[model samples]
Target chain A: MFIADCQARLAFDLLAHTWNPVLLWTLRHGPARPADLRRRVGGISPKVLTETLRRLEHHGLVTHRRYREAPPRVEYELTALGRTLLPAIEALGDWAHTHGDDVLAAQDRAR
Target chain B: MFIADCQARLAFDLLAHTWNPVLLWTLRHGPARPADLRRRVGGISPKVLTETLRRLEHHGLVTHRRYREAPPRVEYELTALGRTLLPAIEALGDWAHTHGDDVLAAQDRAR
Candidate 1:
């Protein structure tokens, strides 16, 4: 009998969000500031991105460096823990790319 | 600029639901009846399981067969496409098992 407290549930919950995987993928190259994230991850609003980043940070998957000199600068990067999810998410993305058409075909058949 | 109509989005959307992955995992061993699914997956209501199975079937992940005996019987099994997701989901489960504690610790720190 499994409840929501399971580790797998937690991981699934993190990936459940619409933008989390995309956000993680965008950060794969390296750290990026908020403006750059906005440009790269496209279609996510500034407010939503802030919220998502905060959630990821709280989950230990992302870290933000704040340079408190002159005009403060902040950049967000994936923590080692956060980077662990990249391969998992990429595997899923690959599966989706390769076999997603079958799912769509099934949907059409059901319709 | 990526939009909602992508394959990755579709895959993420499927896994975003709490029980979809679990239900799929439960079906990995072989075919089972609805009652067995309820007992194995635990905590999922009958209605939700039906909905989940229907969605998975629509997505071409599961198939149900009925036997027209004196006592009718129904069983659900994972399709080849459904089997494809098992490895991906297991990878996520593995990541969760390895790093879930870190996420919990981060949550504690955020508080």
Candidate 2:
């Protein structure tokens, strides 16, 4: 049993946003520039992506580095803390892969 | 990499709600009446608890049974499908226990 303000609830809050886990998962492979991230992630506007990145950075799950190159490259990478969450995310993914249809079927039955 | 509408996303959506996982966890022990759940869970309004239970039932993660006794009694229990999610929830809980302080520190640093 967990209290409403428990630390576990904090972790859940971090994942409550739709894009947070998605962006973290996207960054799992390695660092990538925002443009590359946009192309890879798909359907996210530049504005929302930037906002989400800042949010992740604020939470210390991600960090950014800027290169003083011709076009000024900026790459986002997961911090060690961020990497720690990957397995849990993968676990959720596995559960979805296995039981997603059941959940959908349940939804249909309710409807 | 998950697409916007991936099944994995569906699983994340289920966990995105704050009380969903908490209530699911509370009922993990066994069938519990609504009043008992309220006392165990704490701080949740009877209305919100009712709504969350209905949501979980609609998702097929939980089921309810009614007894015709001196006073009618209703108990909520997790379905087999719901039981399957316990590991994933426990995994999240473990992560929180191990790394929750780090996350909080990060938040403090950001502030």
Q: Tens digits of per-residue lDDT for model 1 on A52-76?
A: 9998988889999999978889999
Clashing pairs in 1: A16-B16
Q: Which 10 consecutive positions of candidate 1 chain B have the poorest summed lDDT?
A: B1-10
TM-score of chain B of each: 0.92, 0.95
Best by TM-score: 2
Measured by lDDT, the strongest candidate is 2
What is the per-residue lDDT of model 1 for residues B1-111, given as tens digits with 9 covering 90 to 100?
134457887788888787889889888899999999888876789999999999899899999999998789999999999999998899888899989898899899988
lDDT for each residue of candidate 2 in B15-107, tens digit (9 for 90 to 100): 888788888888899999999988888779999999999999999999999999978889999999999998888788788888999888998
Candidate 1 local lDDT, residue B62: 96
Badly placed stretches (over 4 Å) of model 1 are A1-5, A69-71, B1-5
